[model samples]
Target: MASRRKTAIRLPRKYAKDEVIEVKTRIIHPNHNGRMAYKDQGYIAEYYVWKIEIFYGDESIITVSASAALSQNPYFTFMLRATHSAPLRVVWVDTQGDQYTESVDVVV
Candidate 1:
């Protein structure tokens, strides 16, 4: 199994109903592009977060496809309409098939 990495998520704990809310997220990753050669080893394999998905309850709020072009520990921000209090789930999937998930409770 892959080791778990650090992740951060920021959002208002409470919001008005039907109001647009801002969400900020980030994950710690090496984001190797498989272009650099190691001292003893050959070129490092490409490994990065290929997809990121956010869900408000059961509905998908946002989905993104990332590549080596993104910087290390990529950051993302987006807006969503808060319709009710629920759990906001964030998932990041890497090229190695590892998945990281974090959840925050939102109140309205």
Candidate 2:
């Protein structure tokens, strides 16, 4: 994967009881496909978020499959239907066992 220039996220400050919430997220990383080398070593260790799971109140809302061509620090924007107040949790797992997580509070 290409390197992501920026890795971050943004969400609405508030939402209605049954409003559709927009969630945006980006990550800064070099999704090395484990086929390249920097200087030393025959190869560079693999690092990438192979899967991302987004959830609301423990219920999964969206899941995306990523690839190296997806670019480094991939950014994604999506919407989720929220019926009440809950916490949104995001979890990312890379091939190297690196785990990243984020959460947001949704108010209805």
Candidate 3:
């Protein structure tokens, strides 16, 4: 599959050291589950995001395993402690083995 998906990352502009901060992320995808009929084209194939990996700097913070049951254009929000300046990254992998990544700098 073609990798042309859009991603977004939102974070606070200012945060104190060791302060808990909110991180928001999103990805644009169809997330087809092979159940939708397209006129006379039969059912759409089962294609959706299966895994998501979150990283704070070089450390893996969270990993999520998903299925076709997930909705299209998934959005996720989580909290993290602002320890130091580092890059917060999120990676999404679909059933087609396509990867989409987005990152933002978190300054403590």
Candidate 4:
């Protein structure tokens, strides 16, 4: 069930030390469970991004447990203080054990 999904993160190219910044992330997915019916289909099988983990540099910043209640192509926005130059990574896992990851460098 592993496949590549379009994932993106938007942030500033450079930030000042201790400056609070906004991080926007998105993943292209259907996000449907077995309950939702589709055209000509009885019900869509269970498939969704079940978990999301965000990391700044070496520190774990956030972890989100998601469900099918989330809309398709889920978008997320959050704020964090830019403390140093490091990679900000987001990891997403789907119900079928599919994983998608995207990262951006936070330069301060």
Residues 1-108, candidate 3: write the lDDT tens digits.
Answer: 356649888998878999998999899988998899988989989899889899999999999998788899888889999898999999999999999999999887
Superposed Cα deviation of residue 21, candidate 4 (Å)? 0.4
| Cα shift from native, residue 99, model 2 (Å) | 0.9
lDDT of 4 by residue, 53-93 (tens): 99999888999998788889888999999988899999999
When sorted by lDDT, best at the front, the candidate numbers are 3, 4, 1, 2
Q: How much is 36 displaced in model 2, in angstroms?
A: 3.8
Span of ten consecutive residues with least summed lDDT in model 2: 1-10
lDDT of 3: 0.90
lDDT of 1 at 47: 94
Clashing residue pairs, candidate 2? 2-72, 3-72, 4-72, 7-26, 7-27, 8-26, 27-73
The residue ranges of model 4 lying beyond 4 angstroms of the native Cα positions read 1-5, 39-41
My TM-score estimates for the predictions, one after another, are 0.87, 0.78, 0.89, 0.88
Return the lDDT, model 2, position 4. 41
- Report the C-alpha lDDT of model 2 over 41-63, residue by residue, as the tens digit: 58876777789888889788789
Q: What is the full ranking by TM-score, best candidate first?
A: 3, 4, 1, 2
* Candidate lDDT (C-alpha), each: 0.87, 0.76, 0.90, 0.90
Q: Which is better, 3 or 4, measured by TM-score?
A: 3
Candidate 3 wrong stretches, greater than 4 Å: 1-5
Q: What's every prediction's RMSD, in angstroms?
A: 3.0, 4.4, 2.9, 3.2
